[model samples]
Target chain A: MTVMSRNDLLLFLGFTVVVLAMPIWLHPFGAAYPDLLQRFMIYGIFAVGFNILFGLTGYLSFGHAAFFGVGSYAAVWSFKLLSLDAIPAMIFAIVISGLFALIIGYVSLRRSGIYFSILTLAFAQMSYNLAYSVLTPITNGETGLQLTLNDPRYLDRAMFEAAPGQPVPTLLGQSLGGFAGFYFCAGFLILAFFIAQRITSSPFGMMLKGIKSNQTRMNYTGFNTKPYTLAAFVISGMYAGLAGALLAVTDPLAGAERMQWTASGEVVLMTILGGAGTLVGPVIGAWLIKYFENIFSAINENILHRFFDFLPDGVDNVLVAISSKFVGEGWFLTLGLVFVLIVVFLPGGIMEGVRRIAHLFDRSRRSPTKPGKATPHPQPAE
Target chain B: MFEVIFLQFLNGLDKGAAYALIALGLTLVFGTLGVVNFAHGALFMLGAFCAVMFRQLLTLETVTLDPEKLSPWGAPLEIREPLVQAWFGDFGAVLVNYSVPASIIITIPIMLLVGIALERGIIKHFYKRPHAEQILVTFGLAIVAQEVIKSFFGPNPIPQPMPTDLRGAADIGAFLGMQANVITYPIWRLIYFLFSFVIIGGVFAFLQFTTFGMVVRAGMADRETVGLLGINIDRRFTIMFGLAAVVAGLAGVMYTPLLPPNYHIGMDFLVLSFVVVVVGGMGSLPGAVAAGFLLGILQSFASMTQVKALIPGIDQIIIYLVAVVILLVLPRGLFGRRGVMEA
Candidate 1:
């Protein structure tokens, strides 16, 4: 392992502390609000995994939802057949999602660029359609698979009690605790983040980067790039699966909507909107988007009127009219504008903007002389 | 059983025309500009709205007064004239009665302008971006466009009826001495099929015959070389993008009467058309058309009781099944050129 400077070590410790403290710090807010923080963390984990494949390897798998949906179904099924313990259910979900990814990524990775995207999209839509119709017995179709209170849970069945008319055990016979769910989700997200960090720094991750930059160069160097890319694809898919398992653990249901192409597109947007190649960027991106979707969407006209009551009548009406387009039914329009602006202006995403700001401050504080010309600091900080 | 099969086959062709038209436009854009225009479906929706606009225009009258009102003694009541006359006159005008044909004529220029504006306004900026960005921006544009249309047209499928002459089904099966209902295909559907074939032919012939097309084909192969030759290929590509938009729009206009035009009809068709493009081999026009019809027929057949008995929900997935099988077998799609996506 490489030695790190004091500042670097402190930064690492700082990030770790934040990750560990998030659930506890946000617990009060999360408790009052219900599952907002938990959902963000889960989707953040999902986006991080997606970024590994798309941001690193440049192979955008539009069928990622297939893995996600599969993972959820697998997790729920494990609770039904094997145990209600989160560990085994999560393991089953990851393994199944990884297996599904292996098959889909194997086929899709054969093509490159738009064709590859289309192929994966086709596969995802197929999964969605099949789950809605053909695979109803396993997937439970449009109604989605729900936990039954009466299930013969091989483990922890005695610990759980059935609610009246409930078909499945609820949260291992304990009352549904908000803080517990938040912590559980936060723990998994931290684990996923660490895994993603480790993977991006590993030799296999380097190989994937090489494939992204120039596959022909890798081929010339006598490395078979397909298997490496495919492996990355599957691993990332498994990470997505883990996120899916976490979702099911939090919510205890799986629906066909999870497998839709729109869901796949959502992840891609998160990855890109954050810095695709940056480790923490996707997490931030996911959190921001989820927050917008949850919070901004809840503000109705009455709430707006209450907030702006001090203003005069005509001006207040005008303000409401203008602000209405930024929320409620017009949120998607604003979202589209945001996406376009991001893509057109900040190609490297929010992280790039952060990097530029950091550099600007660093440049202003430093000596006037160019570093490479007169000083030992030959490189501007990466 | 045979009658049912024959009916489905006709139904398949009607659907196939739509697939073929959209796929044709997509392929043209892909072939020339190397862009997979995800917003093609939105453009199709816009085209349908154009037809709706025309329909509204033709139906508009300031005051449609009735002169049949009478007093107690049966004296006829006087009626005031309408403030504004019918725009296209009445049933005596061919264009007023025959809306489909009229829509086609109007939609072509309208679609052409829309295509040009879209190419210049938005898609032009994305020319150098990655395919993912292209997809994202176009997808965003699609949502915005659809929302705009929805705001204007409302969230409903606006039905436009075919001409009375073409309202009933053709009696081809009866003339052929088969069961009377064997091939009772609608005349409008047949008109759409013929229109599709004509447009497809015209698009192909234009690309195949024109000098401008020669340059485009050259550019698609090696853009840098074509640029070095001082051809200014981007302009041609922009035009090609517009042409592609027109193609999608025209498809939407003709298709409005067959199936009512809705805001999301484009999105519903987007996935299927992209599938057709891939099955036809990316950037291959003939491949798109062939794959469109092939998948259309397969889908129709899959919906049959015979196929559904074997594989339940096969109809919903037949296109994907065929896509998977084709990809497995051919790898680069059915007609994809070698080295296109070999990596």
Candidate 2:
């Protein structure tokens, strides 16, 4: 493992504080609710993991949701068989998802670009279909894999006597829910982010970037690019798995829908819409998308009426009617529009927009001091 | 057993026709424009909705007072009659009954316009971007298109019944000089298969016989060389994109009778069609067609009782399994060109 620099360490600590305090910060927005907050952290971790492979390596895996789903399944099984403690479940998830990613990445890495994407897609779909149908005994099919009261839970039994009511996943004996769940997810997200940051700044990260820039050139120079990409793929898969495990830890249900192509597409959208290859971009993208999904989908005509209540009656009605098409059931439309606009206008995504705004401010501040300096500085001093 | 096999084979052919049509269009776009269009399936769904919209248009109604019939709480009863029937009488009734087929005429023009608009408005800008970017933008477009349809038509599948004349089953056993009803299939399915063949054949013939198509084919092989030869290849490529969209749309329109038109129908077929395209070999027209049918038949066979019994969940993942194996062994698909999208 590479040691973090002072600046990197500070940045990691700052990120940790922000993530841990998200509930407090988001309380005003009314989005600090446990379920949504946990989701933000979990998906943030997923996007960060996805960025590891897609951002650095430029290999787009369209089937990452399989790993996520597999992780969830593994975690649920651990809960059912071993213990309600999230540690073992999460470890099982990471290991299983890593193994699955190794197998898939080994096969998919044979081809690059779109072919690789299609291959991963095929594999993911196969897993999804199997989970939905043939593996119904394990997955429990359409109803999903849920914790049954009769589950053996050997470790839980050995460690402590069973409590009354339905069993929930926990850290030691403290049940994971509400703020505790969010914090748990935040801890994992921070760990995942720190690992991702190290990977981005490491020598291995440079090699991956080289492969992304020109794999052919790297190959000609006697570098075995395969293992590097596969490593990235596996690492990212493990990240996705960890996120999935967290999901199961927070809420003990594992649905096959998580492995669907649409779910995979959602991650891709997050990575791109937040700016691929950027450290913070994917996490921000995940947060924005999850926020939109939770918030926009909940907005109704009634809410719209309240929002525009102070306007004239006819005007209010018309505004509410028009806005109604972009929220609630129309949230997907809004998402699609945002996706298209981002890809079309700002291919670098929100991170790029942020960078551009920062650039403008930097230039505005420096122009007053150095009026005659015509040459734009390519690299700004950190 | 023979009868079962024969029936499954027929079923496979019908399914294959759909896969082949969609994949064929996909191959055309990839070959000509060098862009992997994720929204091609959306075009297919839009085509199906066109049929739905046409049916709605033909069945537009008007109310009139019928003085002879009085409602319990009203002075006179209002009878609703189709505006088409009121205008064209018997011909209008016939038109309404055959709306699925009649929609074909309108669907072609509308789909063509849609194809042109999509190519011009969005895809034209993305021709130079990376495949990933193309995929993202087009996937976004697909979602938007699907959602728009959902908002308009709701999420339910709208059943578009076949014409009354084509409602019954066709006895393949009788046609094959065997006992009747042993090997039977729906009349509409046969029509769909035949229609796919005609359309596929027409597309092939158009490419092989026409001068414009020759230039497009040349462009596909070497874009720069074609451009250097003073031929306006971009315009031809745009037209090809529209043609491909029309092909996908027409496939969807005709498919309404087989599977009801739904907003998510395109997405359901999208992944399968992409699999078909890859298994057929990227940028290979014949490969796409062949793979489409082969996978379709293979899927049907996998779903057989004996097959499923032998390999519990084989039916669900047969296509993907085959794709994985073929991709591993062949890499370029069955007919994929060397170095095409190898980067």
Candidate 3:
């Protein structure tokens, strides 16, 4: 890893402060709760890892949630046997998911384009199906894996007399429930952001970018692209694993649903929705999505009526009736519509929209005093 | 043993027909438009909804309240009569009974308009974009389509019954001069299989005989050359997309009797059909149809108790498993052409 420059350090610092102060800033949006905040951090981590593979390499592995689910299952098993501490769980999750990715990636990397996507999707779906039936001894089938009484947590037993109340996850005897868990997840999110930042700048990252742009050209140039892609795949898989483990660490339950294609699609959407290939975009996208999922789903018919109360009775009823289709139970409709609009009009997603706005501001600042002057086109730094 | 095998084969045929129908349309679009349409499944679901809408329309009744006769806890005695029955009597009843088949009339035009509009509206712009963007936009469109269906239909599976005459099981054994009760199967499923064959045969014959299909096939072979020949290949491709949509819709319309459709049915079928398409080899019409049936029957056989005992949950993921092996072994797919989206 290369040394972080001043700009990189500043960006990291800003990200950290913003994440840490989310509880305060997010209060207005009514999403300051630890669960939703923890989700923002967890999915942010997932999307960041996803960005490293997708944004850099342009290998859209549709089966990433397999690793995420494996991570969660690994974490829960670690809690079942090793320790209730999140550190060991995270470690176990990352290592297991990394290996899982290595095998899947080795085979899947042989193919490219849609075939690669399908290959990954097939593997993940297989894993999910297996977890539900054949692997039920470990996965507990549809019931999912959860911490139960009489589990042998030898490490915790060695240190303490009995498990803590509520069987909450801990960090070296410090309780990690509630806001503490949020911070723990936030810490990993920041770390993930930093690592992603470092990788995005590294030479290896450039190789991945080259592979994304044109693998044939790189191949003709005599560079072995497989190992580079495989490495990125493993690293991103590890990130997904860590995110999954964190999900289990906070909730202490793992389900097969996490391995489903929809879960993988969610991460992909988060990455694209934020603007793939751009640092902080996936995180921002993940945050915005989580916020809307939490807040918009909570908007019931009563809330819509309240929102539309300012209009006349007839108009209010009509407006509320129409708007009601895109909120509450229909929140997914809003998400789909927004995502479609974003992909259609703004292919670069939220990041591109932000860039255009920023560019406009910059252009206005430069050409304010002049009329009909050609604005200098400079390459915008991603 | 023979009975079990034959029954599973029939089951597979039933499933394969549906899969082949869906995959056929998918491959058609992929071959013609060169776009990965994730919304193809949504088109299938919309076709199913057309059936639902047709039935609802047929059964729509007029209600009148009579002040002379009031019911208990009622303002007035209400009388309800089906408007179709009142208008056409016996024919109206027959129309109601055969709504599933009749829905094809509405589904064709609707799906065509949808496919053409979709091609012209969203997909036309995406032709120059990356495959990732194409997938994302279509995937987004799919989600929107399903959600809109959910909002309108309220996320519940709406069952469409097979026609009354086709409701009971047919004694296939008797037809084949075996035991009377042996090898019995539902009449509707058999009809569905035949319907799919007719549709598939029609498509192939159309392509084989028609001048239009020849030109379209030529365009599929080489779009640039066909364009240089002073032919409007793009418009034909757009029409091909509409034809694909009609195939998907008709499949959906017929499939309602087998599996009640909710908003999510399209997605469920979409994944399996993609597997079929890939296994059959992308852009190969015959391959899609063959793979759909092969996988479908294999899936049915895998669900047998003996098979399940040997390999638990194999039935649940047989298609994906087959897809993975095929993709790894034969990168171009089973019957995939040399360079049809192979890169």
Candidate 4:
């Protein structure tokens, strides 16, 4: 077995420290609250997994939310049937989501580009429609899949007695909620990040990137690219499923809305906005978007008024009126504008913006005689 | 059972008309510029709002004091009258009554302008980018457009009723020499279907017979070659985009009376229409129209009580299911050309 490199070890340790300290670092933004923090970690895992396919292989599966939703459903079902322990539920979620992804990925990988995207979208929408309507016996329809008091818990009945209040999912006997839930999600997120890092740096990752660049060229070279792309798709799908299961672990219910195209779009946006090919970029992007969703939407007219109170009366009123449109109910408008601006100006997303700033500072500090060598960054899939 | 099936078939035609119109515009943009316009549905929503705007404009009120009448609070009562009705009397009343149909006249020019402005302003910049970027930017634009409409009209569906003359159902059975009440269809829906045919036919005829459309078709086939012939193909492409937008707008304008227009109506139709476009074969006009109606009929049939009894919720996903099956069997779709968007 090859020994771990010093850089990889450092990166892993740094990632672990940063994620574990999220509650502290996020304190200033007021998004450090447990529920929101857990969401950030979960979605980060989702975006990172999504990057494995979209960033590396250039296959955009618009139906990943199906896997995510399926995972959630599976986790909830596991809890209903088994003990309240999250270990079984999480395993069930990942395995089921993987199976679903394998089937979907196998079929969808037949086409390339927009056709592939549309096919996945169609399948996901089918799943969502069925889950919402005819699959109500399992999914419980619009109200979502929730644990019932009389659920046949073959494992739980033998291990534990019924509690007075609704039971929450636990790790061993420790309930997965509050800070405990955040840490649990954070732990999985770290593991997911490590797995994604290994995939991105491996020979398989290079093969996927080759496919992204030119599949015809790869095929001409006698390389069967289909299995490589399919493998990437399934791996990413499992990542989505893991994230979905984590969502259920933190909160014990699953809604069909999780499988909607918009949710799928959200992960796509996260991956792109962070920087698709780069490892840390998606996690950053996920945190940024989730932070905005939580913080921006919470800013009502009163909050705006409070911020604008120091301004002159007329100026404050005008500013408040203008700023109000980009917050509260208008957060989506802001989100849309952000998406357009990011795609237009910073095609490489926030990471590119950071790189440019760093380059500027680096150039200013270094000798003027040396022209900075341009690094060849991989262009995002066409 | 026969009557039920026949009614659904008619219902399917009406639904098919909408799908056909939207997909037609989508194909036009894709075929010409090679850019996917996700905002096409928003243009349809905007067209619906044009009718709503016209109604609001015609019903603009003026307050006049009535000296003969007094309020219960002892203030002189003011009467509110629509300015158009006061000015043109019966003609104005008829205009207001038929505002939805009347809006088509205004909708065309406005939608054309909207289309041209969008192409010139935003879409033109994206022509050279990747399809993914095009999709992302356009998706963002669609959201913005929908939100703008939502801010103005709120999130609720705005019910636009048909003209009183067009409100009643037509007796199809009587016309067919069957029982009088055996099969009936709504008057507006029939009008809508015929209107869609005219629009579809008109678009095809324009493409087939007009010099401008001929140039555009040639350009679609070989853009660089056509450009070498000294034609201003770029400008023509812009105009084509506008034309496509107008087509979509007209579809929406007429559809207001059928399904009440909501801000998210564009999004609701966006996915379905894209499926229709893909099913018909991207960049194929006749394919889009044929697939639209075919899927529409299939969807309506799936919704049949007997069919639903056999397979519940099939109607909701029939289009998607068919799309998946078709794509798996035929990757380029039923009529899609090989090598087009394959990469």
Candidate 5:
């Protein structure tokens, strides 16, 4: 495979620089407020990792949250036992989560297709349930694992001395509730994005795509497909772990809800919505959905009544009733509709949509080309 | 210990009945149509709603009884001729004071129509799609179904009381003299258990004895071959889907008296039923039944205080835990037909 093009490299660098500068850029408009952008990026990182498995392998895992939750739990545990250095905590988190994924993947990957999906889902639910009860000491039961005053962080514990009777201690000098947590999460997301991008362009990624397209051909061609798939699965798990660690780092807690199967399904939705096979698609998808969730959920009837004041009272009431079904408790309805539309109309996702637009412009530019001569379109960089 | 074991065993059987019924419908659809009916749970909820509607028919209410010519009690009780008179007039009027059996007679046709409409309206469009897309759409449909039910049922469990004759508990332990309170199983649950057995038996017998059943079985095994032999496979498959829906609905209907029916009731059971179907080996009928009972028993055993003392929270995950172990050990499931899941 050829190296990435100079233009693409520039674009990647440009994107990374912008992401690094997001907090400052988003400050004025309060876009960075509520840590919303950071969440988009963190979930984007999680979705990108998830896409590597589902999008590449066509084996939809419905239990990725198990890894995510494991990562969070591991990181929280690290903070409780080891020093509060983010590096060590992150490393321990990813390693533990990857190890858990390795075992789960081994058993689950034995069955392919929907069976695999269900197995992962069941495992995730089992883990979530176990965490809520049997693993209460570690998971802290329904209350979840948080940084307590009792946690001995040796080196930087002084930074997090909560006032007496203030309950749980904050991480470093910041609660999971502020700008520092957002930046910390966004930084990891950028790194994860670059790694995911590299992996997709690598030979290993091609093998996974090959496995998706035709496992029989790969088998007959002398490749032991299990190790390749398992490797991909482990890498994906590590990414999930990193995302989870970042979530805990920002939020300073790990709850059983993090491991629920619905969380796993959300990742699948994010990956697909963004454009599964495309590197940037999952990020965009994650951002789009998270945006709707945080923004749309707040648009209540009072807001609607104020906005549509020009309409007659009766008509406005009807409109509000209709619109409410597409938002709020009915958010899934809108999400499901969008999912169906994308699946039916845009099978390749938003990236495909982008490519089509580019192709259209390219065609118009080549309208005056000489007969029997092909107007050049850029070759796909390896 | 014996008493505990016996009670747990009965508990397993109760839960097993629900699992087996849901699995049976799923298996029927999978076996015959080559489509996984993911909305089976919705159909089950619809059945419970049917039971609720049936029970509402016989409920007698006194509206302060026109007391113009009353004695010392001051009010004469008078029942309103329910609003059913404005709608079905004759049919609705007849149903106002009828017994549950009469109401059930009315419900079967309504449930059947609902089953057919659901299959033809939404599920038909998904038959040719990939399993993921099918799952998504059905998942979407299930959400819509549940939401619609919530709108109608007010987002709460609708209590459907059993007929007066079936209200008390049965004392099976008294016959054995183990203890006076050894087995005081609820009468409604027992009736539900018996009802499920009868329906299951009837279904099996119908499939086993009839020519139509033979053709459907043959079609299930090899649709192309059946089609080549001039059978209308699509029509039969559609019928089978409808039949599966009805079966699910009937199970839900009978199960309502045991537990109150709710909008989200279907989803609570869907995940477990899917596991049962998988553990039973995809499309295997007997496997679904056996796995359903096995998982049910394991779940009950896990929920026991003794088991909880050992594992802390075995009850919450016992079914899934058992499913994972079973899948790992027997990938094709306990009674999986060879080559069914060769891929």
Candidate 6:
């Protein structure tokens, strides 16, 4: 086997360190709490997988939340049927959601573009609607599936004495809760990043990129392109499932709402906002949004009042009144404005902005004679 | 059984009319301008809010402090009078009742201006951009529009009651020479159905019988050739977008009584209307109208107790199921043209 390239080795090490140090580094932003921290990792994993399909293969599936929801349900079901072990639950989540993704990906890949999007959307909505109503027997309906006191839990019951109180998932007696769970998810996030990077650098990843840039040209060159696209879809769907499993692992509950189209759209926004098709861009995007949701949204009218008290009374009131609409309950309004600004001004998202600034700095700091060395680092799809 | 089926069919047509109206405007934009408008539903919402605002205007009340009278708690008495009713007397009372329908006059100009402003401000710049960029920008615009409305209306649904005279059900069976009162349906719902037809017919007539529409149709068929002929087709497409917004707005105005208007109503309808457009065939006007009624009727029927007993929550996903099946089997939708909405 070929040795890992020097740049790839450096990127892997850098990404792992950043993820491992999230709890420490995010302290000043007031987002260092374990639950929120776990969410950042989980959604980071989700957005990265989504970038594989949307950013890499360029197939916009609007129903990835279906797999995510399926993963959660499978995990919870495993907890109820087998044991309170994270392994079995995650395994169940991945395999079951993988099967679901395979089936959905096969059918959806039959048609391309917006039609593919519509088909996936239809399938996911069907899953959500059925899970909410008719499939109540399995999903437990609107209340969502949760660990029950009288669950069989054959493995745990047989292997060891059952613990009392609200049971939590464990890794061979070590509880996967709070910071432990965050680390568990962080490990998976690093693994997911590694897999994504390797895929991007592989020949198969190049084939997927080929389809994205020009499917017709690829087809003219005699590539079927179906298997590659389908593989990417299922891989991304499995990633979504893994993220969903992590959600269940942390919280031990799964609701049909997780599979809603809006949830799927959230991942899309993260990818686009971060920089689709880039290695670290989606992770950054996910962290930024989660930080906004947790930290920025905490700024209520009282905080705004205190912050603006230094100005003239009239000016202070006016500023607070305007700023109030972009925070707290109005955070979504700000989210909307951000979306507009990002799409209009930064089509390549935050990563593009970063690239441009970096390019300018590189140009200024170094001599202009080495022009080839300063070729702007380009995203695969772009 | 016949009466039940007939009633469900009418319900379907009522729903179908709404679907048709919204999808019509969407398809018009897609067909002529080749832009996927995620904000079309917002236009529908704006129209509904127009009626709400107009009613609020007419029902404006003035408060007076009555010094001559005092409450039991010793506070001054207060008197409230609706300004319009006080000014116009009985005529104003009738006018307030009919305000929902009367607001159509204002909804037109307001929606037209909104439509033109949006097209000119945002969509015009995105003509040559990728479909993903178009969808994202418009989706963002939709959120902005929804947020603006929520800011003004406070996110709760504002119910607009129909004219008091149209509150009761009509004896449609008797009108059809069948047994009296056997097939009763709501009067306002029937009016909405008819009003939808009037609007649809008006849009069709406008497009089919006018010189301007001919040019617009020509532009839709071949933009380059028409542009080569020195006819400014871009201006016509801009007006077409405005015209689409007007159609969607009028649909929303007439629909207020059936379902109350909320800030989120547009989003709720957004996906369903997109499904309708896709099912009808992308960029096909007649197909959109036809598919709207088809899906509407099918949806109502799927909700029947018998149907539900057979297929369990089929009613919840019948539209999506049909779309999936149709797309898999037909691919181009019910009225697809070559190279439209395809990858």
Evaluated on chain B only, what are the TM-scores of all the candidate structures, in order? 0.90, 0.97, 0.97, 0.97, 0.88, 0.98
Q: What are the per-residue Cα lDDT tens digits for candidate 1 across B1-343?
A: 7777777877788688789889988888877776668899998889888889888766654543355888567766555432223343454256656766787778888888888888888778877777888888788788778767765687888999888788898887998898676577788888888889998899878878999888888888898999999999989988888888888989898898878988888988988999898888887788999888888877888888888999888898889878877876777677888766454
Off by over 4 Å in 5: A1-3, A7-11, A17-32, A155-177, A357-382, B1-3, B50-118, B151-154, B174-181
lDDT of 2 by residue, A89-184 (tens): 999999999999999999999989988999999999999999998899899999999998889999888977877789899998897889889888
Docking class of 2: high
Clashing residue pairs for model 2: none
The fnat of each candidate, in order, is 0.58, 0.87, 0.81, 0.77, 0.49, 0.70
lDDT (Cα, tens digit) per residue for candidate 4, span A70-91: 9999999999998788999988
* True lDDT of residue B154, candidate 6: 83
Q: Global CA lDDT of candidate 4, please? A: 0.91
lDDT of each: 0.81, 0.93, 0.92, 0.91, 0.79, 0.91
For candidate 6, write residues A339-380 as lDDT tens digits: 889988898899999999998888777745665565475325
Please give the TM-score of chain B in predicted model 2.
Answer: 0.97
lDDT of 5 at A267: 87
Q: What's the lDDT for residue B177 in model 5?
A: 82
**Per-residue C-alpha lDDT of model 3 across residues A6-44, encoded as one tens digit per residue:** 998999999999999999999997889999999999999
Q: Candidate 4: where are CA atoms >4 Å away?
A: A1-6, A369-382, B63-78
* TM-score of each prediction: 0.89, 0.97, 0.97, 0.96, 0.87, 0.97
**Fnat score for model 3:** 0.81
For candidate 3, chain B by itself scores a TM value of: 0.97
**DockQ, Cα level, model 2:** 0.84
Cα misplacement distance, residue B21 of candidate 2 (Å): 0.6
Global fold similarity of model 1 (TM-score) = 0.89
lDDT winner among the candidates?
A: 2
Q: Higher TM-score: candidate 1 or 6?
A: 6
Collision pairs in model 3: none
Q: Write the per-residue lDDT of candidate 6 for residues B1-343, one digit (tens) a residue.
A: 8999998998888888999999999999999888999899988999999999999999999999999999999999999999999999999999999999999999999999999999999999888987777877888888888887887788889999999999999999999998998999999989989998998999889889999989998999999999999999999999999999999999999999999999978877878898899998999999999999999999999999999999899999999999999998888899888778765
